[model samples]
Target: MALLSYPRRHPSIHLLILSAYALFLLPILDGLELGGDGLYREILRDETVLRLKELGKVIAFSDEEGVRFQTTFLGSAAVAVQDVLKLNSLEGTANALGEVRYSPESVGSYVEVHIEQGPVLEALHYPLAAELVLTLETLCKEPNKFLTYDEECGCFTEESLAGLVCTVGELLTWPSASNVIPGQVNFTVDIRAMDDKVRETIVTSFSRLVLQRCDDRLVDCAVEQKHAAAATPCDAELTSRLERATRSTISSMAAGVRRAGGETPVLMSGAGHDAMAMARLTKVGMLFVRCRGGVSHSPEESVMDDDVWAAGLALVNFIDQNAVDAAAATAAESDVASGFARPHWSQAAHQFGCNRAP
Candidate 1:
């Protein structure tokens, strides 16, 4: 697997890095975490970690002992920061603050590259998408139902299980055997939406419906909220860079293939990502490569090499662009601090909907 490595040498004053050991790569690599975040983190570890550490990069792993050390450490740091900032939270603010302090040693931007998990890109004929919104996921589970099953015909019909309020999947019946009736059934429901209210309503309504089904069937049912995550918006500035980088990369890679016209489409991620967590501190940008048939989280999930190559180039471009933008901003700040007046700079900022100094 190729890694995106820029800045042959560490140029930033401080580089705070976060990595996770990949347990999700079991299918790809035996005993080695060589996929997902593990792959990218390993790339840095092999090519850049030691080299950048000498230059003052504080690299931290998200997990060490089945615990997200990154979040815990950052959370503690956030508490300290909150105390220093004289901010008190009556409803508990530890998690929020930790996400803020997780990357204190950084002076660079955050960028993530992922395959677009939906069919939007394929449908729109776009090679890449800059995600604007992230949808929240709410997982609910129904457990242990005593149901009658037909032995000869492999079918179990539960009349009371109809009229569900939300789409449910991963339904399993306990003691799944052809010889015996299933005494229990377990199922999971996954609900997602861009709006929090919608998600909440669905969850509530779905839970109520499950209870109604149980009551009507005279079957005892167990339901629980497995997991819930709120939506997080991508950073505007970082998202813009992502768009620019994707456009530049796509244009450069457009020689052989027919080009998809129009500005890179801004898409909403129906899936959650690590970016949602990192968004607590610095700005985060994401580049979504088009996947084959928009299939994801399954064996059918795939992407064309061109789209993958486009994504890689987009990432490299974004990194380079971020450095350039940082330098420009620093220069502009220096000029302003040194009392040098540049009317055109102010005019340019105004034209771009940026704040200008009086």
Candidate 2:
């Protein structure tokens, strides 16, 4: 829905599809009972699939977890789109939900633009980056061991947790009141890393250590995996193109500007995006714009006007470059098919200005 106005702005661009059903929002229930709840109703609708099948490439303005619908009420839980649809038997609702089925060739590639959502870009004073990576969320329950420290636990050691980032973003307790000791505690653990193997290893080690420590203390503990996603890397070719576009845009904006690392920065995103899911259907790439203090999902989250302009200009440059490359490739194929000698590598490079930076 974010790019719905793109077609109006750029008339040359064809077919900007909006998959509104992909929206994920907070769950709300009010005694509504419905049947037909399962995997059969969780897939993309036929209409959406047909629209996607028409595109050779997709350019998405991806936000974290699609568009988040927030609520002011405390203790409200987030729910998947499929679950929300199941509670209603409204007209056309059943037809819009189906079992999973998608062809890999429907779309050849995907590119997303998003916010950095972390402090790296702000700290370095850069406007944008080509990001790669994702996240896993888990719920851990223990009996009053929230503040307990165990020196012997390997999971608690710096050596075992190296290169891994873990955060307890949510917590819930029973008998929550002053002068009352909580009998049970539940907390959500979010773990992330650039490498899937390292992340998985850390998760396994940490869960095992938690269970063993709880057993030794004669208290009950359980680690339930609420959500998990393997690290998804951006396509190498697309990432290179995006980086070039970003560099070009920044240099053109300020000819004498100094870059923190003397080059366009590449970052690893610990947060998840819709691009991760799109990766299953086609190649994926991402561009991240700098946010104030690398903070997101909070009232303090902000982006500079110049950074926003840079991001938009970079995307335009990336798309234009892609079109040029595609046209060149098409011409070469046509020449070969018509029984004409193909252009030499050097000549082709010169014609496309491949030797020129960006």
> Could you tell me which 10 consecutive residues in candidate 2 have the lowest summed lDDT?
71-80
The TM-score leader among the candidates is 2
Expressed as tens digits, the lDDT of each residue in 172-201 for candidate 1 is 887999898899989878776655655676
1-358: candidate 2 lDDT, tens digit per residue: 2322232221111122222111111111111112111111112111122223222222222112312322111111111113223333333444454322234543445676656767777777788888655443222211112222235663444443344568887799888877889898899787865556567777898899999999999989999985667777788988898899888777767432476566877776666655565566567787887776655544555777566656656654665566556556556667653322222323332333323332
Q: What's the TM-score of every candidate structure? A: 0.59, 0.62
In model 1, the Cα lDDT at residue 125 comes to 73
Candidate 2: the clashing residue pairs are 118-294
**Candidate 1, which ten residues in sequence have the lowest lDDT sum?**
21-30
